[model samples]
Target: MKNVETNKKIIQKKQVKIYYLSPEYVYYPIYNNNPKFFVKSKSNVFKETLLFEDNNTKNYSNISGQVMGMKNISGKNYLVLKNDFHEKYSAPKSFRRKVNKLTKKEILDILNENDAASYSSDIKYFINNFESIDSLILNLLICEDSDKIYSEVFNKYNSDILEMFDAISQIFEISNPVIMLSDTDDKNIEFVTNLSGMYPDIRIVLSHDKYPASHPLLITRKLNLSNALVLSSMDLYYLYSIVKRNKKVSEKMILISGDALNSDFIVETKLNVLISDIISLCKIKLTEDDVLCKNSAIRAEVVSIDDTIDTTVDAIIIAKKGNNNPKECINCGLCNKNCPQKINPQMYKLNNLPFPGKCINCNMCSYVCPRMIRKDI
Candidate 1:
């Protein structure tokens, strides 16, 4: 126990690369041991940074902020917007007003009406595209009551995970797969394990951690994983499933959250819903005359929802100000001081440190900044 604690302290002292892995396969990998040191490869790292920066709209080499991923497929491209994924958006009033008893059809219709595609298509696509396989390993945080969504299939297979496995086994000749429970709560893990055990041959492993252990690919690689299917949260999966069901299911789940909006409510919305519609759902109280946001402050570009009206669109961000480029160092050494490991932040920016593979990407520097400067890590 002492040795374990000592090792943890040492590992925490430096930067680390954390990733999330999917458990849709039979065998997955785990690092032999926690990674100790990071190799900084500037050319490789910078190239990767540029690849993910959405587009070359901003010059990143000269900037100290982190790069973000933003790619729009709506025929028109825009700058990457920094919005909260976990943060909720406002529920549509009509949808909320009628929330007395939402049937599956009403829910699907509401999402369809708002132009936000449901998860129906994506799920069907997974079922269709992949060769009929007998095994399934879902990441727990991503699973919702799919039995509720796919009533017909759930009804046929009983939607009980074990039943689903049994049905799958009948369809494809393969061994039963194990479900990895990412939750540390002993109760949740045991519940899933018990439920899974109902199947003839199924195994379960419970995991306890806050962030995703690593990207699914890395985890599977470490575990020697070869074949599997992966899934995400309900909303995302819903969208994917809907897309699979119908190609026209192009609606998106626009998540708006953070200190900006005091409320967080996930809503299904259309791919082309106006900014005003989104704000209305978000329950933002800004009047037409009141400045909605600081155009230059947000990572996303600004656009008008209606040319004749003053209201912004669902995709617009109304902040209080713009971001200022860093010119002078505060000399407080906060960036270096707050680093999980004692890495020099100044050196990171100055090109003195060529490789940032060790950086844990905890956003400690961004969190402690006086300027609220955004880093898209």
Candidate 2:
């Protein structure tokens, strides 16, 4: 009778359910350690699982004072770093110095003194051939759904999209400013139309029929524009704050999503915060075998929870481990047919041709593969 009772307890433990939430889908329990069986469409559970209230306001640290110098490379100007910007500005003593003490000439001189090989082009461009930019391209397709997390964050921050457009125009002396959106779904297209209607001076272009349509090179090719500057929505927001409000790039907007999360929401936090810290704040629980992916599942790399978050990270995804025991390739030729860049993935592996330099690493071939081979190999 004791053995029978022990068996019953073991069965109960095996049946324990684990719920996970993502921006677009949800899943429950672990069956054979596979997420395929549990995947389902997102539902009203998102409202209850919201980690942050709609009206909650967060104060972010500012670091515009550390704008060491600007480097113009290949028609784009990048903000050079100075004096451990992310760290020093996030520290307690950062507020003691109310204003940035460095002048434009002083910042340039510092850039010259550093004189690293990597800094050569930028320093030389800024010194010799500095010209006012002509155009700015605002990329709004970074989020999976523009109407969901991104628009919510934009409205919550009380940022005016038109105001941002004007600010960037004036700062860069840009005459042709364009807002590019990827037409992945009907809702995204509708949102882009409504936004474009509000701003007459800004041009809106929709990219269709590509996996990574929002990629900078792809956007430049699709739009047929040259010498144009590209900036993400987050980048424009920070730039507006910097030029108008004297703010800095101290805070970052992060999208927390994936099947392993209990709830998925967008959170604004200080730069350099540890990934573990953000997970704790959201009250996320992870099992020993579950995996955490930085950015998108298709393009980003898997990282440990202990890693420190970088400024460029836009998304954090938690997912079950992928199936390593893939079946043999059936050679249905679907990988070649569906490849957006038209590279023969199968033939590339066989060394029938040189390396596919045009491959964008979008993972579409692997996604469409019947045998689950890694095309990126």
Candidate 3:
């Protein structure tokens, strides 16, 4: 295997402090524009209730609630729900004790039946091509686009995560399964390192704590990983919840951190709950002038408090708004130099060059700028 380059700088982003938030409301976008719902308007939805499904994944209610009505935002329809706060579980919750005993068909069925797929193609890919996969790589690092790590889950659900991880590898024709963690994450590194001896089949490897280190493509490239099923911590969390805890997919852990607040934190809240609600519930000290970036600070698009969290949304960075006035580009050339894909973002802006065809959206071109002026232009 190729070695992880030591030249990469360590990422200073902090861990998402865990919080359980029960917002009064949550919303779900109408899947494929018009979804065939098992629940209608004013219908009572218990927790773990299946609302919809597609070829890739399934959607389940995270909270017990009454469907209030429909909401339309920017031509998209959302099912608005008022949380009853009871968290009543749907009927027929099943738990599997002997994970290793599960057959290939049974594993696929459980993933589909219990909403383990959870709006991600990662799980769906297993159902279709498990036989062809040569390795299973569990990416315990944060999502590529975000600044927070789900390190807490590795400690909290270590046994279940590893259990499901090993079982999936055993069933899916995977031999050299690897669980990748950020070396800078001392908490997870310590926990997993200590517990790894029990699961001798699974190997624990540390990735450089660097920006874009969480990117799956970069990871595969660096590790020389091919024919590997790379999955995020969220995927495994859903697997553990669905398979072990017998819980439905609803609440998700998201990073709510930035200098705009007194402290940085993460909230495990009902999906599609308003960001404003979470801020208020957590007593986050965000002001009007403070900017909220949906994923990364390098991302130019700002998300307002009115926006709802979708399943795919991983973070809301509350930061004091920076100066929008343009500054003359410094001659440091860091943007061009640091770009992993070697895209000349400066030329795109300074010379009116069309944006390069192979931009990977690493955001390094924007993040490395000393003036913070280069936005992958």
Off by over 4 Å in 1: 1-137, 142-178, 184-191, 198-203, 212-214, 217-229, 234-256, 260-262, 286-347, 352-377
Query: TM-score of predicted model 3?
Result: 0.82
For each of the candidates, give the backbone clash count: 47, 1, 1
Top candidate, metric lDDT:
3
lDDT of each: 0.35, 0.48, 0.69
- What value of lDDT does candidate 3 attain over all alpha carbons? 0.69
Higher lDDT: candidate 1 or 3? Answer: 3
Candidate RMSDs in Å, in order, are 19.0, 17.2, 5.0
Worst-scoring 10-residue span by lDDT in model 3: 1-10
Candidate 3, pairs of clashing residues:
62-250
Q: Which portions of model 3 miss their true places by more than 4 Å?
A: 1-21, 30-38, 48-59, 71-77, 141-147, 245-247, 299-302, 325-327, 352-358, 371-377
Q: How close is candidate 2 to the true structure, as a TM-score?
A: 0.59
Per-residue CA lDDT of candidate 1, range 1-377, in tens? 00011112101112111111111111101122332212122222221122222221211121112223323333433222222222222221221322223444543454454334223343444445435533455444311111112221122222333443433333344454655554543544555555654564656655543222323443444345566544333323333233223222223333333224444333344332334555654667654433342111122343443211111112233443334454455666656665654567655654444437766554445444454332342
**Among all candidates shown, the one with the greatest TM-score:** 3
Give TM per candidate: 0.39, 0.59, 0.82
- Ranking according to lDDT, highest score first: 3, 2, 1
